[model samples]
Target: MKSQLLVPAVYDFLENMEFEGFDQFYEYAIKRDVPVVSKAVGNIISFFVSLFRPTNILELGCGIGTAAKYMLTKSKANYTGVDNNLERIEVAKRFLKDFNKLKFIHSRVETFLCGTDEKYDFVFVDSIKKDYEKIWYLLKPVLTKRSMVIFDDFFLYGYIFQEEAEIPYKYREGVRLIKRFINNIKNDPTAEIVFLPIENGIMVVHYEG
Candidate 1:
């Protein structure tokens, strides 16, 4: 979900930054209308991975492994990706076959989170916006203050800030839910949230609990 909110020059500068082979996956996602993370967003996530150098990485709603590729490019951290779509999981596994430290789980995020006791030091979530609250709740059990979690498309292509009437019918409810989720996070004493206006609003979260 690319953002149209940036000025022309600023947008051009960011888009011009090279992610080398990432353009291929970006083009593939565009052609199929899949909801993969934008290269700019993916780059930001990669930046964090390089900085944190986490031992374990978890990705929810990993579509075709685009962002996973970016994050894993400079790091040797063991990665786990969860997606409910079996077909996409297969595709991701094939696409990222070179990465021996990674595994893709074809399971609903709720089920996977509930079943796993392993905590991840870093997480990237690009799933359904409306289900973010539930996902966040499930994630708390698996996150630490040192963990960095990034959620994609929180702005919903700029719809999250629009009036109820301004938003398209299909996205209005999801946008509302995201706003509520943000507010709840803001009120929580044990959680920290930071938003980056990079390509449809990326929310970075950490749990201090």
Candidate 2:
């Protein structure tokens, strides 16, 4: 994907904003080539967490617990993160060990979602685009009333709007799936969504149905 900014001026403004203790984990993630939430994305999560004050938060594809940490900083909520990456899960466990209500489960999103009977007040997803529809459908039974779901990388690094021929072979499938996911959510009469042109794109969904 190209390096075109989704919101160039807004990114420039947020780039200057300081994240006090996040630099440590940020640097570690950079060194390990692990994808973590951007400062702006984290800030947005913080905003919602503070605003909603959800009692139970679920995070899909939590990488190294950066986003979880950010959310915890903003609000005191019980958090559960699920991912298949063992190494990343380990990092998350170690990083967030001090947080009493935090838990990290090393399992696929579908596995955890299907097996658990727990309900969540909020969910943040940063997982495979192709599995998003399946995940959302499965998540329905577990979501409380007026729950909000935040999806990251919805713009697919600016490739979602491009032609299939223009996109690389590997990214084509993901782009298509994200488009389909967005379209499905948009057409769903029970859903309310707002698209934010952030670092990549943050799609916030409120399931009213």
Candidate 3:
């Protein structure tokens, strides 16, 4: 449901490549209308992982492990994926059972972040838009100085830039929160952030300025 306003032919160009083992989950997600990371987003994530080779990876709101497939394939890092939905977790586990060092947990992103003593070098979050700031506050405790976090759907299908009345009623609040987050992060001295108008748009951040 991305607004075609920000989308150019680039997404179709970059997304034409095949994901050998991910097609099944991708089809399932699309057929079910579940929100999964776009292939363009997955590609950038893979590029980042290939560049950094982080030892530990974490994904918040990992729906059906679509993005995790790209991440685990690129790096040998132990992958931990968290989602509040049990059904999605089960399906993700079933789809990703072949990956040896994978762990999929059924828990809220904030709860998992608060409880874990783990440190991740790379984190991808595709969570509820309205909960971004709330989860963000709890998420910082789990990262080290070198951590890189990528938050997907920052543009919310291009409705973020639309007039409030133009955006669908259901999505209006999420768009507002994204605007709030963009401004808040920009003003924070400790955060070095980049917003890329990729598929659904992504907000990339470094934990330390």
Give model 1 RMSD, 1 decimal.
1.6
lDDT of 3 by residue, 1-209 (tens): 65353546776676777878878987898799887777778889999999888899999999899899888888899999999999999999998888889988899887898899998889999988888888788888788777899998888888888999999999998889888988888987777899888877889988882
**Per-prediction RMSD in angstroms?**
1.6, 1.7, 1.7
In TM-score terms, candidate 3 sits at 0.92
How much is the lDDT of residue 82 in candidate 2? Answer: 92
Superior candidate under TM-score, 1 versus 3 = 1
- Write candidate 2's Cα lDDT for 11-67 as tens digits: 777856898778767888879988888888899999999998999999999989999
- Each model's lDDT comes to 0.86, 0.86, 0.85
Q: Report lDDT (Cα) of residue 140, candidate 2.
A: 82
Once fitted onto the true fold, the runs of candidate 1 whose alpha carbons sit more than 4 angstroms away are none
lDDT of 1 by residue, 75-177 (tens): 9999999998887778788778888788889898999999998889899998888999889999988986668889988788888877898888999889889
For candidate 2, the per-residue lDDT at 136 reads 89
Question: After TM-score superposition, what is the CA distance of residue 22 in candidate 2 from its true location, in Å?
Answer: 0.8
